[model samples]
Target: MGVYGRRRCFAVLGLATALAVGALSPAAASTGAGHGAVPAGLLERATVVDLQTAMHARLLTSEQVTRGYLDRIERLNPRLNAVVRVNPDAIAMARRSDAHRRARGARGPLEGIPVLLKENMNTADRQGTTAGATALLGAQPAEDAFLVSRLRAAGAVILGKANQSEWSNFRGSDLVDGWSAVGGQTHNPYVLDRSASGSSSGSAASAAAGLAAVAIGTDTDGSVVYPASATSTVGIRPTLGLVSRTGIVPITSRHDTPGPLARTVTDAALTLWAIQGADPADPDTAAAAGTLPSDPRTVLRRDALRGKRIGLWREGHVGVDADVDRVFDAAVRRLRDLGATVVEGADVPDLGEVTTEHMLPAVLTEFKHDLNAYLGATPGRHPRNLRELIDFYDRHPDGHDHLLFDMADKTDGDLSAPAYRAHREAATGAARRAIDDPLVRHRLDAIVTPTSLPAPVIGRERDSAPFAKTTTHAAAAGYPHITVPAGYAANGLPLGLSFIGTRSSDAHLIGYAYAFEQATNARQTPRYLPTTR
Candidate 1:
């Protein structure tokens, strides 16, 4: 960057920090799961499936449904900032879809569901996708991204795009989890001061807040699961190839996956189906058939968890939040009460074997290639290339298109260097080695762990947030993992337990998750402002 640019960054940050600290300003409402109360209107309203039923019965119009979510975001999102850009045309789009519904029965299982997608995902509509950065503010793809096509085919109302950590948090080190240029920092609903783990921060917050029935998020490492757990919601990270990544903002293709976030497992499972399917454009997803289920996702067998053999792998990087552990313990007992064969053991497949030695260069190279391909093929407005995107950020220092990890990023030397080449091989090797094989050797249906190390800690440093240490294992393995609220901590924050399995075990994992969720009805609506002890 030029000398003047460097000086300006320091100036901007100085002002932003000062503002962030001196704020005790009260808003009319809050949706930050980290520190605010759950909106009553959303909870009292219909669930995701209920929206479908209403549409089918002619009780609600798709346009009306879309308008409702938009209204909710408008009424409540300012306090949480979970939704960065409201789709100004959402109601119009919904009206068009409503015309289809009137002519035919609902087109897909998700018909009329108002769903929020991470801004990184491309859509054919005029909606802009910047990955929560100011750099690509004007970049709206002409054609829908792969998964977006599926969502549209499913008749979902693409409500609005959510905020995420800038560039999926790959821009630099020392990044805050939920700070996005477009949306600002998303506050956790349960505790306002706690971090809203990113880079899918807005997805998690939006789902937990009841702004939408379900929201979609992407994970490179704990991006979805960690944030879902932190915010007391169900978020699933399907096996790597289970969902298409064709038009998503890039991080590492090897670990990136688009998943669903919802208040309940059924809602999440439904959204998952809508997004899954092989995309010829994305070769990685060609193998999706083996990993995803064709079964309808909204159906739940409440007794599915009963009489099942479940392996509890309690040893991971879980920070053992006192409130979280208490919740987990109760959940385990509920499992037993429900007639599940539960085994608690700590022989998780790998810890030291896969991590110490690593390969990341391979992943970064793929990221550049895959991202470039999407950018080139995308029809609408967007950065012509990654290099141009970086340049744009340089020209516009606005937070709207910026999630700053490092001002030094613009100065990083040539990525074409041999050192960069070697780095890719090392990181890929480590990821492949550390993930999957262990689950295979264990021969388990699903491996379970506390989804996160700690309950959301108010004002905790982003560096301390558990993502790689807790989630990268499953991510690297290319396996399916789901998080369900096990119970609430004494502090009233939610604690989550994760269900992970090998690549093709998505169905089994969901079935198991459903069973557990039924056995332990631990999720409770947040009261917005709980009295702190």
Candidate 2:
């Protein structure tokens, strides 16, 4: 996952402020395994499928499940800073879900499940959509974001908003991944002092700690998958148009798309199924017309990797930490054992050019336009345009980074500008070629790489350390990217393996990821250590 900060430093997308399912229905999730009282530690590691089965079997009530999550958040969030706010009406929503389940049946897989949303996603309710910046504090959205509305319709309990990188880490130079002026810092659950690679910091951390059943996060580049990798959870960055962007804070309309972070591939797929569809508000979603499956439950299979040709992007693994390399080597062997033909040396050609050129200018140009429109339409007294936003940040400079915001404000905010249009076109073309060329040449079903170096320590030391990531091509191409727990570093930090597929191949990638996840069973519940020993 390439962060937006320090993109210039690495020439490979860094976050220096810029730069960058299916599913079974609720009824089908049960394998008849649930009985009696909610299993011990259910809230800590229960999959959405597990919860649905328990609720369907009358072993657990939605309110009880909701309460379980609330209790955990109450006890753990102060230290993790993962959940920024709790919905006062969470129980009420859960109770309503219970009443519905009683009167009829489960609304869907997400019915009554508590979900944490990245704070940038607008929720027209008690929770604030601050995007982790004081500038937007108390800025109530006029309505739920398109995805949020879909989740609510599917009967999900809006548990609360998870903290995130301020302005999705787009406001400053040398931005810290999980630190926000409004929410403070979110600690990685596994190793508190380690970075929970963000801007979706809180969502991935919360999902890792089971603070909620699952979480929603936006990815312009590495935002979603990076943190999920850092926290050893599942994160899917869908093909851009598969999920609507309406109601979420903007980064670049070109690449920003909200997706799921969950503990299991199954949960991630189910969450995607619940919230994905075409929306008139987001014209990009027009491409999703026939892309989504009616039932993602059928998409998952234990043998999905069998007889498939998988390519290893070893360029992503070279010059990494030895421990991470060892883990990735083992993961490659495991893929082979599971019947996938592992094609070595399948690196995306011309990656340096893809990374160094086109992206930043296009992103900055679009951010100016999109944020102005979003703020103008939003119901708040906050700055309604880019200049005003820059001025707001300038007035309150303490602990804030506004260099990137200032850069964006200087732009004319015109998508039709020749310079902006040229960069946008070239960026997408290069990115698409980087991913598609390798697949066709190798006859590969998908490409695999290490999602990221295990979460780096938080602070100055990380600046000099290499930030290995593999999300850029997928992000820029507007294709599908999914990360799953692969192994752990010696200090107990989580490692993730990523699967990248061509555009609109989300279901196929999910199936492959699920197969690998089941084969390895590599994920271990976080122990909440104060630091890596």
Candidate 3:
């Protein structure tokens, strides 16, 4: 779902609530424990349901829940380095929430919930709008991103920001997935030595470790869902524009959008609701609002598949990790038992090769323009353009801008302004046709495929840098992508099943995820063991 942990192109952008990380007992928070304990009055260990229950019960104050997550971050962040810089002021905000609850009574579903966000997502508060760059490390947006405001309106406590691949890993090749100049590298919660796929590495890792109940992350390509797949969590890449992109760091305007990462489907849904809406700041929403469903919660029925036609992408079965395949097969069986008509086939059209042939150029061009505007617009930022920002990185010693193992010269990658418009039109138009014609031809609900290749072999696996070109196809089309936990690999890493749909069908797409989540209930908490054996 990403190309970014959530950054750059200067225009790069991006919440809080009073919510607890959830029902984990103090003992469960201990990595040494055999079974993690789920505490009373919070979300059930891996789902959003109990978090709502706990907040409603008044058994836990938002401050109590926020403190619990902050406590976990204190205990675990040193090892994982997932959070770039936590807001020192978060606890105070929670205390205020607690006082409000005590005096005025509870407010809403997330009255006392805490949620973390990717650093690139702008918060008007103490956090900087760096986009993983040392150049912008001191810059904070003049105002909260629209999505963050929504979360605040919902009574969420703005927890902290997570680390990500610098510039969302858009600096050419050989960029490590979770490394950011501001935060450094984010280690996988399940395996410290192994890679956590970007650009939402921090969101996935922290959530997997139970550092927070839910987090906001942006996905351009596989950024959100892939990390969830790699980390064994649920990542939803909402349809383009379902969530406003008024302040998110840019790749291509078409594909860049923020999303949610959580232990379960319902949690993602909760986060999604808080963020989804039209914003006057971004014109994209005018079209998006028309295409999106009004209320997803009602349509998210547990037995949704009881009388439905479901098609499984057979492409995922081949060359997949054995453990991941095992979970996938079992998940399919469960869907069948839930009363679905299941169809399995390797029949996806030849659109696979389109990723490289048509999309990468669009991102490169759009990135230059979008980033410049973002940098110029940010309240305290000094760099006015991509070249200036890159130059700033070179002069600064902080690791923020020095990400790629071989940083391509900015001069080589920079495109003239006209290129952005020409490239955008060609790429987006093609993508729209490819997505629409196929869905209309097949008369399908959505197309399902593996969220990512099987989770890489732990220490035994090789870490390959991603291609900038890879994410463009989807980004250009502005379609929605949803990834659900299908099963686990033999090595125990989770496998994500992605559902791609026509533009603006985010609710319908997430509905399938919600239904499937209820049907399979396959999500698992991380063990955080030193070794997988």
| Best candidate (score: lDDT) | 2
Q: Kindly list the per-residue Cα lDDT of model 1 for residues 1-533, writing each as its tens digit.
A: 11111123312223224224432112211111121222235333356665565455444466655666777788778877889877777766677676777776567667767889998998777777788766577676777778888988888888888988877887755457888767788877776666668888899989888788789999988899888987878889998888988878877677789999998887888888778888887777877775654564333567766666566665543433555556567667777787777776633545453343343434545556656666676655667666766676577655333323222233232446686556545555555544444445544456677777544443355445443355766777677788988776666666788887666777778877888886676677755553344
Index of the highest-TM-score prediction: 2
lDDT of each: 0.68, 0.84, 0.67
RMSD of each candidate?
12.3, 9.7, 8.5
Question: How well is each residue in 196-312 modelled by candidate 3, as lDDT tens digits?
Answer: 788888988888887788888888777887788878788888777778888777655667889899887767777787788899988887777755444545657777667665666
Query: How do the residues 1-533 of candidate 2 rate in per-residue lDDT, one tens digit apiece?
Result: 01111123211111111111111123322322222223336678667876776566654677777877888998899989999999999989988898888888887889899999999999888788889988898587989999999999999999999999888988888768898887889999998988888899999999999999999999998999999999999999999889999999998999999999999998999899889999998999997766777878667888999999999987746666887798889999999999999999788764575455678888989999999999989997798888988888778777656888888877888999999889899999998998999999999999998888878787542563475458888888999999999999898999999999999889999999999999999999988898765
Evaluate model 1: give its lDDT.
0.68
1 or 2, greater by TM-score: 2
TM-score of each model, in listed order: 0.82, 0.92, 0.83
lDDT of 3 at 191: 64
Stretches of candidate 1 off by over 4 Å are 1-45, 297-299, 317-319, 349-357, 374-442, 454-459, 463-468, 530-533
Model 1 TM-score, 2 decimals = 0.82
Candidate order by decreasing lDDT: 2, 1, 3
